[model samples]
Target chain A: QKEVEQDPGPLSVPEGAIVSLNCTYSNSAFQYFMWYRQYSRKGPELLMYTYSSGNKEDGRFTAQVDKSSKYISLFIRDSQPSDSATYLCAMTHLRGGFKTIFGAGTRLFVKA
Target chain B: EPEVTQTPSHQVTQMGQEVILRCVPISNHLYFYWYRQILGQKVEFLVSFYNNEISEKSEIFDDQFSVERPDGSNFTLKIRSTKLEDSAMYFCASTLSQGPPLHFGNGTRLTVT
Candidate 1:
């Protein structure tokens, strides 16, 4: 199985709508979860990162991790056109060294 | 905020030629990495560097692929003999420490013809 899996959604949402992006992993060892936003051909930009389970909030972005279920999610509230980008879920184990696995990003289009 | 910066936003070369992609990571960061992304695929890890040595590398990093921090401020990936399959966006990333949430550069689009 792929270490990390995510739905490659071209998810379209109206401005101010809430957006939820998620990913699941088979590795029980994953401890650090992160969300990265990529605009077109640009490189991935770190959006939010969480070290433990539950939720970590930064402004309109909230990142959640469930180590028990090996699941993670990123919730964007009151989304704006600027949020229209590909969102990729990434995670790594603190003990696994520097290799962080990335998910196939979900494309988001926030219509203004 | 200081950010990683990659040079020559785009590079095109012959399949058998050697190509070097360069990057300047955040001044205060100590760990550096190289990643690749095919046109429609997910970003994949290539290799990671710290303290002037390779700390970790994925299967994709083979004999043909090599990374070096030639100087204190520059990190580079050199493909010994590029193949058509080498065409992709090569990103250079770094973090203050060895872990998740890497800060990435805009990337260099390599086209091997």
Candidate 2:
């Protein structure tokens, strides 16, 4: 089984809708969780970051991590067309290893 | 805001040819990384560098793949002999310290034919 698993969704939603993207990881050592947004042909852009098991909020985006469950999520509120992109969940162990593992990424489309 | 910059936004090289991908990371950043994503695949880490030395590398980063911080400002990844599977989007990233969010460049799309 892959260390990290995420549905490569082409999830379509209307503008202003709340979107929930999630990922499950099997590695128990993962402590740093991150969410990245990537547009077509562009590099992944860091959207949210959280350490350990907790929730971190920034503007319309919220990142939640549950170490025990080995799950992480990114909640996008008031989604807009401009928000359409691929969302990637990335994590690394707290031992300061730079070897980050990433999910396959979920494709999101916020319609107008 | 400063950002990582990569050169040769797109490259097409013949298989077995040598290719060097270059990146200019944020000036004050202490950590540098190279990652690649094949078509429709998750981004995979290649290697990481700190204090002018390689800190870690993945199995994919073999003898043919090497990284160098040639001038203290420019970080580069060189593939001694490109292969068909080496075609991918190569991203260079940097961060001020460990455990923080990484700032990435637009990426260099490599196509090995």
Candidate 3:
């Protein structure tokens, strides 16, 4: 099985709607979870980061991790057209290593 | 307000030629990394560097690939003999410490013909 799995969603939502993106992993050792935003032809930008199993919120974005279920999510409230981009979920262990694994990004489109 | 920067936003080269992609990481950061993403694939870690040495590298970062911190501010990834399969978007990233969230550069699009 792939270490990390995410839906390659071209998920479309209207402006002002709430959006939820998620990923699941098989590695129980993962302690760092991150969400990255990438526009077409651009590099992935770190948007949200969380350590262990908890919720972290910044402005209109919220990241949640459930170590028990090996699931992680990014929630975007009041989505805007400018929020249209690909969302990638990544995870790594906290042992000072470099084996960060990334999932296939979910493509998002916020319509007018 | 600083960000990682990569040069030669786009590059095209022959399949057998050697190519070097360059980056300048955040000045205060000590950890550097190299990653690549194929057109529609997930971003994959290639290698990580710290204290002028490779801390770790993935299997994909094999004999044909090398990374260097040639100067105080410059980091580079060199592919010994590029292949059509080597075409991808290469990104440079840096972090303040181990396990920190990495900041990534815009990336260099390498197209091998």
Candidate 4:
């Protein structure tokens, strides 16, 4: 099985809609989880980061990590067209020299 | 806010030629990494550099690939002999330490003919 897995979703949504993105991992050693947003021809931009399990909120973004289930999620509240981008989930294990593993990004389109 | 910067936004090279991708990581940051993404593919980790040496690398990062921190601010990835499969978007990323999330540069699009 792949170490990290995420659905490559072209999930379309209307303005003001709530969007949910999720990923699952097979490694229990993963300690840091991150969410990144990428536009066409651009690099992944950091959106939210969480350490271990629990939820972290910043503005309209909320990141959740459930270590027991090896599941992670990112929620976007009141989404806008500007939020249209590919969302990538990444994680790293410090004991492994911080070699981050990235999931296949989920493409999102928030229509106006 | 501080950010990582990469030079020569695009590069085109022949299959047998050498190509050098350059980046300037955030000054206060300590860990530097090289990652690449083929068109419509997931980002793949290549190598990680810390304290002026390589800390980790992926299986895809073979002998043909190398990374260096020539100075306090510059981090670079060099491809000794390019291959057709080498064509991809290469990204440079850095973090202040082991625990923080990484900040990435815009990326350099490379095409090997």
Global lDDT scores for all candidate models: 0.93, 0.94, 0.94, 0.93
Residue B15 alpha-carbon offset, candidate 4, angstroms = 0.2
Candidate 1 residue lDDT tens string, A42-107: 999999899869899999999999998899999999999999999999988766347889999999
lDDT of 1 by residue, B14-111 (tens): 98999999999999899899999999999999998888888889999999999888888999999999999999999999999877669999999999
User: Whole-model lDDT for model 4 versus the true structure?
Assistant: 0.93
Tens-place lDDT per residue, model 3, B24-97, is 99999999999999999999999999999998899999999999999899999999999999999999999998
lDDT of candidate 4 over B9-107, digit per residue (tens): 999999999999999999999999999999999999998888888888999999999998888889999999999999999999998987657889999
**What is the number of residue pairs that collide in model 2?**
0
Per-candidate alpha-carbon RMSD to the true structure:
0.9, 0.9, 0.8, 0.8
Model 3 chain B: lowest-lDDT 10 consecutive positions: B95-104
Regions more than 4 Å wrong, model 3: none
**Ranking of candidates on DockQ, top first:** 4, 1, 2, 3
lDDT of 4 by residue, A1-112 (tens): 9999999988999999999999999999999999999999998999988988999999999999999999999999999999999999999889856898999999999999
Taking the candidates in order, what DockQ does each have? Answer: 0.76, 0.75, 0.74, 0.80
Clashing pairs in 3: none
Clashes of each: 0, 0, 0, 0
Which candidate should be chosen as best, given DockQ against the real structure?
A: 4
